[model samples]
Target: MTLQLERDAVLRRHIGPVALAAAVINGVVGAGIFTLPAAMARAAGAWAPLSYLVCAIAMSFVVVCFAEAGSRLPTSGGVYGTVAFAFGPAAGFVCGMLTWMASVLACGGIAGALADTVGTVLPGIAAGPGRALVIIVSIGAIAFVNMRGVREAAWMVTAATLVKLVPLLLFVAVGAVMVLSGSVPPPRPITAPHVFGLATAVLLGVFAFSGMETPLAASGEVANGNRTVPRALFGAMGFVLVLYVAIQLVAQSLLGASLGGQAAPLAAAAARIGPVARMLLVVGAALSMLGWIGSDILGAPRILFAFARDGLLPRVLGRAHRRTHAPDAAIVVHAVIAAGLALSGSFTGLVVASTLNTAGLYFLGCGAAWVLHRRRIQTVGEPVDFRLLPVAAAGGMVAMAVLIYVAPPAEILGLVGVLAASIALYGIMRGIGGRARPPVG
Candidate 1:
């Protein structure tokens, strides 16, 4: 059934620039950044900061490529929509589902992290059944806020984004002051930078900053989409990238050798800021994870909704909530799947397994850019940011290659399974499509 959802549902313009920025910011500062610096330090030794810089440079390519595609096509499902149009419905469905699963699992990870952070501060509160219950409650509340629709969710994210940013700012500012004044504790200088280790360190750094392209996933929901999508993609990512590097630099300077082993890098840096600020880091880390969860709640369902709308899955899930205008069923599916994985302690394993499919979609997006450019030529219309896209495409190719070689094998395996399921689903869809008649009574 080619279910025709309200044009309002399919072509909604519920987002503005502020909401867009929060979504972008929300995507970037999740649990990865909270813990990655220490591991990166271990990998690169003193050169870890430089490693983060490398990842940032690599990500610029993804942002640029995604921006070009987002502005031109302006659809939900981020890379999935771009790939589908470039290829076919089945390709798009597979791509969308992969991305949806990734975002959902990522959210669960953030929920787990947020709960852990809570324990760090309110030791008793974060333990056992109490902490687990809090995680569920926090996730459920945030998910509900997101389901309330764009305007409401955007406001909450914006506030939460600000809440998360404060501690990061203090980390950088206070670290600098401590070093300049000679108050930073005397420590060993693993300070010397190593190139190869730095590269690996920065790959993890890039993971922290990877949320920028997410705005493209909900392109269909933004007002003045063609213009707004690029603005949000480039503007939000560029700002966040700078802030992330700044945060790391500040953190390293403040904590020195001692900092290299910290689980909560910002919190460690905060200790240098003074005892008062240490408490704030826990608040900020918790907020950052919550922000990530909120963005996941907002973005993932759209991909599933896209899949259902296109007849690749059950059409019942294609329906939008009559009042809220949200994809109610898709939201339920995402929440349930993420929760299942979370309770099973399987989110990390899934990340390992889904890496291949995620990387596959990046190449698929680059291929779409090529196809879109060619189609534009055949029609003889003005080229759609044709000049800038090649750079993004090339960057995506390099990034995907690196991720495939470097990402855990289990992630690649999980991706293979998802792809296989998609192929099977496509065959079933094709059979259904063939037997279908023209739309009639």
Candidate 2:
């Protein structure tokens, strides 16, 4: 029931760098991006992009750390694997809990958002059982797709990523044309930056970029993960950063001072383009949610598999389907958990702590990268690029700490509660290790 446990079944490595990048894009650009322009405008006004830039700067450090760790230790569980490698089983267990909980909670919240999007169109599924049904059907569908095979799941993620990006790019393209011409007034220059508001905006931007880590959870299913991880991280992040900045600039230019007030800022901007464009945004938003859910299902369950493989959870979860080579049991359980959270209405309340959990994982990941470099450890895969590893690791940790420090006290307490529970669960896992350790296949 330890790391030395026999693996009777194994995951297939079908995910290449391109598929991984698509998963990263799908993860980062979800339902939030459609409305994020308005939220950023509210916080930082004309200087919203500056906040994005700051967030990107901070995230780049963290991403580099992940790239390094992923290259050196291309295993399942993403940051959890890295932490366990750098630290120990105890710390690794906590990291796994944090990572899995964050993804599952976010999945529930996004499932709710998807139902809301459906409600906008049908209005019947706006609340109650209708909303619950949407959550179940959506997450259930994604889970099924993931259970089929990694290749099929990767294709779904890639398709969803492309579909979701079209409307946003269209919005940016139309807005850009209007701005370049005389159709829309140019964005007003900000005479002064709002420091506190900008800080808040950066926090929001960080959350928008949070899902990138989730995709790494399936590292074991990735081909040449050492090379794929860094390539996907850099490629997808660059695309997202440019796309986000453009969308924000265009929305600000089109809406001007009125940007922050609109609930659906992208739709509002699209409306100015025409009804067709606006409709596209509506459809795109729903697709975006689906894409994110697909990516979450495709990757997050691997965390459960990783946990079980290490004897921290039921070993049945570590088993892959004989034919499909997919973690079917883990995928189903993760989906069930998310569906329950979505129905219980607690996911919304817990989202702040979910973000905090992600930030904490990133901090630990940065530390792991630092430790790996310090000890010159190469547990698996190819050697990672160590250039700027120390400086990047420090900056990443600081960035995560800033996010953690800025979080509400209640959410901080909630994070602590999760950690404490994880510790207790780890003890229980150890106590019943024999019972939990089932045959892998």
Candidate 3:
């Protein structure tokens, strides 16, 4: 009984709606927004904003599915818990491993981006040992804070989210003024329809929206997981959709045909505003990347903790710090892997690998929702309609299929390798007495 109580105390429910919303925002709005504009503009030309809108609309379906599943399980593992409840331990283990891999890779990519941003402002730290040190130090700082406690980590994430948004808000305001005053030039006419370009734009836009489910991973730490998770998910999605589309439009209006050529389109757009705006943008981009890393650090370890508790991973990772009530072991392990990747300077490859894993997770998560709905399982939160749940699931499945179809060949090969390895590992574990099953809530 004492052990049970101790275990219960290890993960306290301290996160409220506001902090949850902030985490959701931080997870969804990262450095991708600042960098993807040029690539998107090149892909869809003047129609890039349209692609953002379309992708957001499509992603809403997946968000709904996540909302329903998260509400029902309201556990630390996010999709892993939901999938396990519907499927079995093996399936859940696969989902958890995939989610963990994607998140760690994403954290590494953000660390690299943070290093680049620092390098931009201070050329002295642009490459070599300086860059490596920045990556290591930044990831170490985030991991330390997360090990302190969930509340502390959530508050830090909240502050970072607000700080990161300041420059983006400024850009939107200035862009609005320019548009209203007719100071911004009109977009160039498309000489011909570009189907391939639109497809590429859609893929990039979908990838940008990948972090929507991040906050759900920490639902166990939330005060009102059922209601809060769904509300925060929708709210964050709506907020980011407006912010992304506005930025795309502003970039197009300010740079026009020149938007596609510049390496940093948002920074280029800010240059038109003045040196102060440009400086603020540089700072904002750095903070946004940091916030992404912070959010991932806080959430991803919880999935590991869940996996450990369920016998999929080493039981040591399931333990939390006695005083801080943080998943210390899992956080340290995750940070080590992420730091290694960051130090290797494989940001683009990590991003691609994560994207591929995320596609599989989305499909499995949505399918889990369908299985739960069919079983008529009792859920904790606002009840979803029977008919609507399957529709949401179907939408998510189709979206994931499209994403997987468009994925680069390298990512596909990496994903296959990871799956094969996971299967072998699962078999070896099962050969031992490692299949201690936990009851699905």
Candidate 4:
């Protein structure tokens, strides 16, 4: 009966490589990019582009590990499934919880950001019930789209990515011409005194490229997932790297020293071009949030579905809607939790905890890639790309270690609490004779 239920709940394979790449793009580029210019400028001034490059190079190591694992274990659980396959169910459960919590926290944080952005245009929606209402409506819309089907969700994500990119690309193109014409000056060169600032900027910039793995959580619904996953990841990463560098350079060129002061640096840069351009960037900021929320809705619930399917969580969450083949219950639950966090304004702590959660994921992801390759495992997709696997895994692990070593004390304590709680819950489930199943071949 249990096995039958699992088989019946399998998701449909509708997400193609291009759609999946769009989803990955949405996941990687979020509300962060809108204000990233100011933050990076504050940390490293005109040398912000260098910080972005450093972070991208470091993140490339991790991306290589993910490319291999995502190709090999093209399943619903994504990072969790890979870690579990390489380690065990208990470890997988812990890693899954970490990834899910980070993603959910990010959703709530982004929701709050969206409400704030809307508030700029419509002051009434900025705070109190107005804010809460906006959060609810936004999340509800995303949840509704996700429930319709993954294909619909993918289409929505692709559209959102286009909407989000247009304004920024315009900003980059116009700003570049301005610099060439001397309407805007070139960015100032970095000095020796800014080395510490450069480090800080790089540290923060590393996370800007995260959320790629979130979309992979729905690998089970991807058509030709093994081939599709790696292609989407690498393609999205390359596009994002180039786009980020260009945006940073343009912002720095136009704003110069004042770039660090604007709350909406891109909008501020656009304002120099004209009022219409500023409005476009502001609107783009809100739409970008919507796109990210949509992508999160599309992918994160698959973690809950996978957990339940494995008997690590309640079985109800594992059930899929018959017609749509979507994990309807898990989708609702994920949105509800995120909305609750947004409305209560308690996601601040979760946001802080998310940094550590991300570090844990990186470590597990790197370890999984190495162990799986060593075992000659290739459950799906093309054969493991062993050429760079060794160097990439080792570098990824070292990078994660630096992240952990530099984390603040509060974040460390929070991570410890999260991990301990996950372990306790897993034990309780096992003690109650949960029908935990082994990994499916």
Q: Report the number of the highest-lDDT candidate.
A: 2
Per-residue alpha-carbon lDDT of model 1 for 88-158, expressed as tens digits?
76676666666766677666666765666677677786567866786778877876876777678777776
* Clashing residue pairs, backbone N/CA/C < 3 A, model 4: none
Please list the Cα RMSD from the true structure of every candidate, rounded to 1 decimal place: 4.8, 4.4, 4.1, 4.3
Q: Please give each candidate's TM-score.
A: 0.82, 0.84, 0.86, 0.85
lDDT of 2: 0.79
Better candidate number, 2 or 4, judged by lDDT = 2
lDDT of 3 by residue, 184-257 (tens): 56656433228887866777777688876676766767776667777878888888899999998887777778
For residues 205-295, write the lDDT of model 2, one tens digit per residue: 8878888777787777788776888899999999999999999988887878877876567877777778888789988988887888887
lDDT comparing candidate 4 with the true structure: 0.79
Local distance difference test scores for all models: 0.66, 0.79, 0.77, 0.79
Model 2: CA > 4 A from native:
1-16, 123-133, 144-158, 185-197, 221-228, 314-333, 343-351, 379-382, 434-441
Clashes per candidate (backbone, < 3 Å): 8, 0, 0, 0
If the candidates were sorted by their lDDT against the true structure, best first, what order would they fall in? 2, 4, 3, 1
lDDT of 1: 0.66
Q: RMSD in Å for candidate 1, one decimal?
A: 4.8
The sequence of per-residue lDDT tens digits that candidate 4 reaches over residues 54-117 is: 8888789898899887777677767777787778878888898888887887788778767866
Among all windows of ten consecutive residues in candidate 2, which has the lowest summed lDDT? 1-10
**Model 1: number of clashes?**
8
